[model samples]
Target: VASKSNLSLVGGNFTLQDATLSASSGQINLVSVASKGEIIPERGELGVQTPNISNFTKLGHIEMINSRAETTGSPSGGISIRGDQFWMDNSSIHADNLGDTDGKYIDIQTNESIQIQGKYFGVISNSFGKGDAGHIFINTPYLKIDQGTIDTSTKGEGNGGNIDIKATKIDVIEGGIIASDSYSTGNGGDINITATESLSVTDKRIFLTPEQADFTSTIGSASLDKGNGGRTTINTGQLIMDGAAISSNSHVSGDAGEILINADSIDMINGGTMTATVMSQSSGQGGSVTLNVKEKIYITGFRPGLSFTTTDVFENLQSAIVLITFGTGNAGNVNLLAKELVVDNNASIATATTGLGDAGNLTIEVDNLYVNNGGFISNSSGGIIGGKIFPGFGPAGTLKITANNEIVVSGQGAFSASGLLTNTLVSAPGGNIEIQTNKLTLADGGTISADSLGTGDAGTLDIKANTINLTDGGNITTSSAYAAGGNIAVTTSGLLFLRDGQITTSVGTGVGKGGDITIDNPIFIVMDGGKIKAQADAGHGGNINVKSNQFISSPDSLISASSKLGIDGQVRIDSPDMDMAGFLVILPGGFVEASMQNCNTRDGSSFKVSPRQRTVPFENKN
Candidate 1:
């Protein structure tokens, strides 16, 4: 590397294609005013330590055409420019595999404007255990880069640098890529951009087209990398990129910084994801963002969690939100008052911790909300959706799910929350709403469950396991009074119904003698297989408490003279020869099952029965 020639020039428009520029074997410098030239070495090498060139002052249009750089041999560099309006076209530049030689691929220290068009400037640092650096610094406030295949690549675990512009506007369009590059930021500017103009993307691809690139070492392989964000402010006027990427920056070791964006209009037609992120040491936040988006906002990627936060808190009452666990969690408290919010099952929006605060309070005031192929809005079961506060405070947050499409809520993996329905159809042809558990209570409609269960306590609890369970884990609570029309509640340790389900109301612990087993309309209370056992009882050891479970027991306190068992429907206790009334006794609807297995009584009050056996008000037996 010491036995090398150093070619030096002053200024001129130069073209270098198919040439080998070696900083480890040769050194070439250009210090000219107006030298229009070319360095297309068909089979030769040009060595130059660009930063080593002493040209504090120079006025020239130096152009670097298509070429390859091999500078990973010593503490030398490939290309360094401090000129006016320097340009590098359809070319490639990089250095790798020579150990820590303090080798840099390209250094642009120019204080004037610069443009990288139709060029593929690549870099790979620390290849084969070697370190590397690269850049195209626009020290001045003037730099324009639009169009090209800039595959800023890094191989092994080392990252190579390229494009370091602190300029005004950056327009990216056509076939431009920041592909095959990695980044680091323990110190320097991984990708520093402080533009006062616009930064927009049109029809472009930033991160490489999903062609997998392998790492060298099992741990630290890649040498170079793609672009990064050095606390950038992408202005709407400064950037008009159809496609581009803010690749990984590894040097910082810490999380990446925030990026402020001000775009007038954007339309993400297809492919490419808008991956905007921020790193909080303990709890970091991003700058304020506002986009007058006209087209669809396609948020895709593994890390598609975009967020904006500040220490500023909104105060009204007692509690305050100090930290937001997830970015999309704000969506539950934040109102999305758009004209339309359609969630295609094909398009999923997920959150880690606090997915959504409360669909209730997070007013999604849209003209329409369509969930084609099953779209869902959920929240953490532990997350709070505070109730409405009148004089003191506390109001129930609400989730208004209006849909022209079907709103079916019945799955093993269901979220914990309440919903208010405007116009809901439950049944075939209209749309079905199935509830596997009675944990739900609709304000108006929406939850018009048409399940097979005749009992509504569960509003639908259709579990058929060897044993049922409602342990410390899962909950089934109703905060406010939905309505006092004709809703019922059932809590039987035994199966409520083997044929249907239970839509019980009473909750907490020992709340009601049992949910108001109301007989509003013509209802059927068939004790065919199971019995309705309530913690409430008049006497005789019936633990059926009337009021308990924390809150006030429902006003099941009937005023008029109605049967405790309003049986307009059939009460066929068809436990034939088993003498069912011995076990299935009702305050209302009287006893209507068979007398006894081997005997009959005139009083019809007391009767004996065998163990584990009962009678059913079998069909045609009433």
Candidate 2:
């Protein structure tokens, strides 16, 4: 059916198979109704109004198979579809502006569900001339897209259109995609998705084909030219991503877009990635990723408690949530707020720059945080990729973590330890690390470190906690290969205990001076087989300043500040006055009869012995 003016299709159980509906410069409306009342048409027109829609008792289904509905003109026409259940199989709906005018929009409203199943196109709104593309709005109870796509793009001088979806539940699997792209000088469009119940995106695929085995379900936007990438936002009750991705990346001079997610709980496993990155060879600034989760956020490399049909699917995959720049522009920051955040199974949350740009900061605020099984959080600038030096030019970003309760970092991963790190391989200085928690525990090779490998100075590490515990080779350290070493400062209100742990700063193969270590106001400092050192190779050693009430160390523990060729550093310990009541023993309050023997004619004498009101310091044996 082709129309020069407006067209309307209103009935029950409407089905269009191997058909075409085209409007040259007008609108096409499809309304499915199941009722006995009449649907009053517009005066001298063929379409019904909004008030007549309520006369229907119920809505019917709409099925479009191998069909196409499009409008092509300078100012293209619009398309509206309203029904109970809507299904599109090997079908597409398009609105394109062929000239220098803005395109019209496509609206879909379903009372029941909306399903798009195909290996090809689903819905598209594009601009081919100098005009802007139109927006796409979808409202349904449940939405499922398999091996399909919904896109809005601009290949001309105008901007792309936005996409808004509201549903109770959403599932995008088997290489399904929702995207906006800019191929010209205009900016890309934004995408906003709201799911009241749940949202899941699964699989990774190499291509979008019916015979393609892998699934790469993606929701992303990209800038292929001078325009900037579009923003992506998601709001859901629960979010699950398995081998899927959500990304906004730049491929040219345009900047990447931001990503915002709000959920009650989020789970990302099996190479699932959430990233905002400036692509290689591009010159744009990377965007940021912000997550606000009410309950928890869990990220892991491999799927737990699940059997995979193809083990190679996740053989070399690693799940990550990152913001990185591999271009000439600066990277963006990552901010997360949640009740609990867990990173496990070789997963990572990081920000890095492998090019000329500077890396961005990473900030996490949670009630409880756990990084175990080789999971790590880091920010670095310049690195050796593929065994070749990148020599990135700028400084690395800072890392800040604040936990309201406790933080536990334990266990090692396949290649790296479970910890937090900041490093720089270029001439720029490394970033700093700051952590604040009520209680902190680092065990089983867990570490917190900052280092520099080039001429730049290493960054500092500052920690403030109520109590700190480090055992089983856990460490807090800093080092510099050719520059001045970084410092470590720890402040605790309670005891600072270390068993087989270490706190050190050193300079290796460099003429730079070593860094300092400071421990302040601990009730007691106890170290069993632990070491605290500030050493240098050719420069002066660093200093160690400690202030505690009582300091105790095992026979094997050592604290030293020594230089190999230059002058040694100083070690200062200041012990304040403390109450001695807890360590003193008082005399008894009763009197006792005592007997004494004198060498005077073998006679025995007896007397009354009274106790004194005095106390004596007790000695520790162990």
Candidate 3:
């Protein structure tokens, strides 16, 4: 049925089987109205305020199959289907505007559940003229979309309308999409979803044919041309995404949109991704991605306890990735705030720049952070694989991590912000890495480094924690090849222990000087074949200064500042008491020298030791 005025179907149950409904400038309302003493009220007129429903209409499954409902005009009013339960299979419902006016809206409200199935099922609000598209509001207790799409798009000069959905539980599976895209020079619309209980988007067909799972079930926004993309925000109690994505991107010369998520807990596994990126051909700046969780955020690369026989590990990596590049524009930043953040099994949070603009920063604020088993958090430039050289132009951005409780990096996990070396002629300097936590631990070949292999100087390492422990071949270094080495400054309150670990810097054989190492703590111990050296092969050696209450070195642990050909650097230790098991050199409150036999001396080869008390001075020659 087609009508110019409003259409009202007041009944206990409504079922349209292979039927069509259309209203060209008016709304179609399917609701139940109350009657008083057998005096029935007349249906409300178009463009007039209608009486609200006296009570919620209870219907036995209002099903629409193979039906089409559309409203088309200059300023159209859409369809409103309110029932206890709703289902649409192989159907289409649209509210489109053809003239230069804003389109109409579509509202579907149900008290129990709403399900849409079939491959050709769609619910759209589109605009073809120079006006904005209409909005789509869905309110239900449970919503499930299987192989269906809910879209709001515009092809004119006006912006697209927003999509707002609120449900207790939502599941979007099997190539389902809820998108807001703009194809013209207009900004895209926003997508906002709030699930009170839980929200999940996945593809279960991946178990049968793993290659078909390469696609993603997405809820996103996009801009095709010079219009900026719109934002996507999701607030849920718990979110589980497997083989799905929530993103916002720009393809042309427009800025990408932001993606913000707030949840109690989030677990993304099996190649699920959440990103905000600018496409390769666009010159627009990348958008930001912010995630705030109350409990924890777990992101892993592969499926847990799954033994795959395929050779493609790239298809199973869950990525919380963000990018702002492919053109001459700077990339966007990523900020994650949670109580505990765990990124394991090669899951990564990276920000890089391949164009002329600089890379974006990555900041994480958490109570505890665990990055292990090939997990990485880095900000790098010169995007060449296998450490190959490229022509670098832009400078890399910094990485700042702040943890309230503890931070752990183990099992080949790396936290690096190193400058990539271009072809030996020109190179950008490495970005700085600043980490502040209560306790920092690195073990099992874990590394935290900032090196410059190019002509630019390396960035410094500034760490402030309560206690720092590095063992089992873990290292914290800052070095440069042609430029001067970066400095390392550590300030801990309790203890700084290094067992078989290294905290050192070396200068190149050129004119660059080595960087200094300064440590200020209460107790500093380096034992079991640990070395703290600032050696310069041909350049001038750097200084090593330690100010602690008690300094102990045992079992072949060497702390040296020596030069091979240039001047020998100075080693200054100012503590109340010092203990070296093999050799004892005591100097009290005055400058003293401890000589070593068969050592080549340069212009200045002196070891200064100043204690707190005024006691006897003894120099030992070994």
Candidate 4:
């Protein structure tokens, strides 16, 4: 199998199968032959050497089945051809090494009457070793990839490119599967189609998600992009990819080989999806991307998410386009932004395997966005999408952003409990927010609404395991239609302070314990420009209790606690102006036998008319 010098010659007619033509470190060529004559070289190995190249015209009737040819050593190729008229069936060329002493590139320069089609995969290395001139092109003829897959991992020690067709017409059929760029980075160069060629890639899916490769150092994983599928540079020529799918995983690449589409006019159409991108770090001084469609641009399936994670410091965008047509074959007007973008709504991008490559710094600022159906957006890497999900938290890694005219949120577990989405609100000048460790207070203009579903104040609207403090200047309101304010739940085992604003709770019956409106810290609740109104008329006793360190309040303010209440610690009844309406009912045996001097006007009709009260905490003995 070491045919390092197998140069087979095919002419007028020939047939060879199950034979291994191992042209290792050698050349395989075809001399000038007449048209209509054929040559068949089928199956087995061909050029498994250093630099296996095929030069000249008409290497006709070639059938490659489960066969392979690759560059051996550091200066070779699997099968380098400059021939015409081929029917390469299920063959592959995995160009692993390149640009050594033998050759730094693999070039296929030909011009003739031929038909190139069939299954082709692997590389046309553009970087790695020989970072230049490692390309593939069938000069001028009708070339077709009936049903095949062509990809590359053009990484360390790789050659030049995947395919470069400077022909009249080209058609690509993806065999109903995807042409993926799944590695971390370093997918061979781009696919460039020059000339007035007609191109088409049949309906197929593709992806370029992050790879789980272990590149200990960033350089070890040095790659510009997954794969620049293809970009066209037309100079008064028509370029079309009717049905095709192009996707990329990582964002380590840029404008496919600078597909300089400097055309006089172009007609682009796509019924499929096209999403090719380069990683952020690799885009050299990245600039804005815009795909300009001068002539008719047609688009069919509008895919879901499309945006390369590029932070180009350039103004405007460097356009990328995928025009489409309707079922009538007529041009379907495409409303584009100087640049054209097409998304196959049918395509679904996969999640990441590692934490590092969770999301792309991709941002889309659209003047208009429409949702055909109810859609959702979620994340796993626990990333932040907005410019800065959280302020001052930078190194948190990849972020995702979604900005639309309208948004809808439904589903129980759609939004995770761990994820807290705080509106990017800027406080008005001189406006303030206050927190009272003692109790809860709401200002006149402040508002607090519940984003929960149940009727039980889910938890404490304001929870201070210890104590809370509130100075005030903002209206605070907890309006829960189904749930109550569970407002100011004090499991703190300390004091609760209520200074201002109105306290309103709307909840049904529940066996859960809510905040006890009793003055406990020095155990005193004080109120000035506020009111406490509680109603337990539905067999649910909700008492409103306020303790004051130094009882002082406005006379017009209403402090009403109409349910059963008790004070075990201390009570400072110094508010002579503010008349407290409501009875203080202590629980059965809830308080230790005690009586104070001038112990208020205890009504005989109250829950408790005795002079006994509790002055100790749950832990203290009587």
TM values, all candidates: 0.38, 0.87, 0.81, 0.40
- Overall lDDT per candidate, in order of appearance: 0.31, 0.85, 0.73, 0.32
Give the higher-lDDT candidate: 2 or 3.
Answer: 2
> How many backbone clashes are present in model 1?
118
**Top of the candidates by lDDT:** 2
lDDT (tens digit, per residue) of candidate 3 on 28-86: 76653223222133343323333345443334457788987777677656777767788
lDDT (10s digit) by residue, model 2, range 336-426: 9999999998898998887788899999999999999999999888864334676667789999999999999999898878999999897
Question: Is 3 or 4 the stronger prediction by lDDT?
Answer: 3
Worst 10 residues of 3 by lDDT: 416-425
Q: Number of the top candidate by TM-score?
A: 2
Superior by lDDT: candidate 1 or candidate 2 = 2
Quote model 1's TM-score: 0.38
Going through the candidates in order, what is the number of backbone clashes in each? 118, 6, 0, 77
Q: What is the Cα-based TM-score of model 4?
A: 0.40
